[model samples]
Target: MRMRITRRGGLVGLAAVAALLVGASPASAAPGDASAYAAKIQVTLLGQPAVTAGPFAEAKADGPTANSLATVHLPGILDTGVLNASASRDDQTGAVQSKASTADVRLTVLGALGAEGAGTRQGVGNNTVGAQLIEAECHATQQGVAGSTKLVGVDLGSLGSVDATPAANTTIQVSALGVDVARIVFNEQIHNADGSLTVNAVHVTLLGGVLGSIGSGDVILSSATCGPAGLPIPMASGAGLWLGLGLLGIAAAPAAVVINRRRRPASALAAEAD
Candidate 1:
């Protein structure tokens, strides 16, 4: 028996991912001296189950540690399903201290896919899917003593979906710097998959202030939470259906196997070396 499969949404998905990554602010050190503060990030998906293939396969991610800056990288393949991310920060200084955090991440769902078939495809043909979850956020804050007001700033960028369903959200943090600054912190969480959730945070504080400048120290904390095993939710199709339809044309090729298999192939295909 012979079946044919063709990847349809490659160009479109690549374009979206590229635009998402390139169209962003260039990274630079905070204006004036960097603030000394701390941050904590946490994220969770309400209705997602565990999966062996989707993003969030590894047990726990390499998280940030005390007094260290943290960075988390998502594997393209394992990144999928519903997503929720948030960040919070608290900072302290000799004259000022305050705290700030982004509580809710509205929406960021992208590139999900669904598949239909009895089992793995044969030698000449294979089943494939393209999935990814991505985001970039930055935050800062400064606070003075009690009775003194608190100033916090935050920026959040996340894009995700089940397939090519395309759910996106972007938020920018804006707060003025300079003052008898006290505290600072930042937190963020990205929904990975059913069982896997990636969370990260960065916290810091100032050793002291200079005559004309400020000095700061910070700690980084990151974590990945994997829930107990359970049923896998049906992944989204995104633009995978387009590809599946194209492949269906071949899978349902004229009178090859009497009738084409009813089962469907993954909506998207990510090129992977066998």
Candidate 2:
């Protein structure tokens, strides 16, 4: 006589099959775990409040003076995760010849990474593993019209990779954003039972400018599949989101000025007419 499997047993078998499919899929199917982490970078140019230099007259030159500020926040979820990050800034001319000039063209950057959390290895229980790392870096620089380059950067390498059991070897989502900068990167490595290794690399880079004006940029992302090669799924979602937000800011700048002008009293607005 034929035997019938119980409904509960059928469901259990389906779950097992699904898990096997996910684990057996190529590396291309999973991107590094970036969705769990978020980063924001902001730069403000204080600009020269008052130009002390007289027209056609040069003031005494002082050494290049720079003021830079940076901050990073790592959530508990990503604590102990590895992070290797850096940032930089520069003027179109690329050189800050003097303190006053440096003030005229200042740069800043900020970044952070999520630390890996505690968990068991996939398919293997009872073993504890270390958290993964979140890496980041930032910097700024100045260049003279003659092509001299002066650059400064800050590196945050505390987050990059972590030790975790197989339970932590699942797929990870990622997102990244930046402005007027060169590159953003996130990567991961996979080790199989056979001892072979696979490395996944994802990065965003900025290129192109015209006559002192920054140009449009191109972004590319990998699909959520690694195939046989362990390539990180480069998701442009982060950069795209940032790009869209930046555009909105630019579009609103003029509106903000108009609104501020309108809010002023009529007498204040007409004061210059006297």
Candidate 3:
């Protein structure tokens, strides 16, 4: 019963698997979806002029939905004050939700190295037999003046569960006087196969990193997408409407009381046979 689409990011099945990730895709959408965005910078090389910037302050929603977005800037690379993504569904009772969030985060690349954040969030929720996942970790910080190092999220969900369905990629390697020079990512969940869900919190894989030319890339921040928990009520499609209303109250409630006493009249059956 709530719908919004201005802070759009995880647009349907994670932009159809992010246009196939470096190349991704998987969006046909169903189960009332949700979306949000705060940043997306895609640069390319090989030929050049392919420096697409932004997916900023984006939002999307459908059916029982939700979405939110606040500020964003892409001067050096990225900046955020608040960005939230959401996906929703009520489906008569089988609730659902999907979300992504960001706040006071900043980034700066090429001008040095890049990474910073005061916040970041990811989500996934479901009902009608169980499904749950929502995180507010990811308070990363790497502006240590000599490069960054301060992470918290990514403990494999307390070292036990794992249900991001088919998507969960997190990596960050940006070193300097020590060596390693690129690769940064932070993904949340994605259980799409129709049961929609796509969260790409942040991803940057510019093909121009280290070599291969100079520009040809990727960047996405605070993305969110929702579910596909198949809903139709009646205990989710079964019991045949409570066994056809208990055989229509045990065989039609006495054939309507003997057809209302044969429709009366015949002088009320000859005045009850006087």
Q: Is candidate 2 or candidate 3 better by lDDT?
A: 3
Report the Cα lDDT for candidate 3. 0.43
Candidate 2: residue 173 Cα off by (Å):
51
lDDT (Cα) of model 1: 0.25
Deviation from truth (RMSD, Å), model 3: 21.9
Model 3: residues >4 Å from true position, as ranges?
Answer: 1-32, 38-57, 63-73, 79-107, 110-170, 177-183, 186-196, 204-224, 233-242, 249-251, 262-274
Q: Roughly what TM-score does model 2 have, to 2 decimal places?
A: 0.15
Per-residue alpha-carbon lDDT of model 1 for 100-181, expressed as tens digits?
Answer: 2222111111111111211121221112222122222323222211111111221121211121111222112111132332
Model 2 lDDT, residue 56, Cα: 11
lDDT pick, better of 1 and 3: 3
Question: All candidates' TM-scores?
Answer: 0.17, 0.15, 0.34
Q: What is the C-alpha lDDT of each candidate?
A: 0.25, 0.25, 0.43
TM-score of 3: 0.34
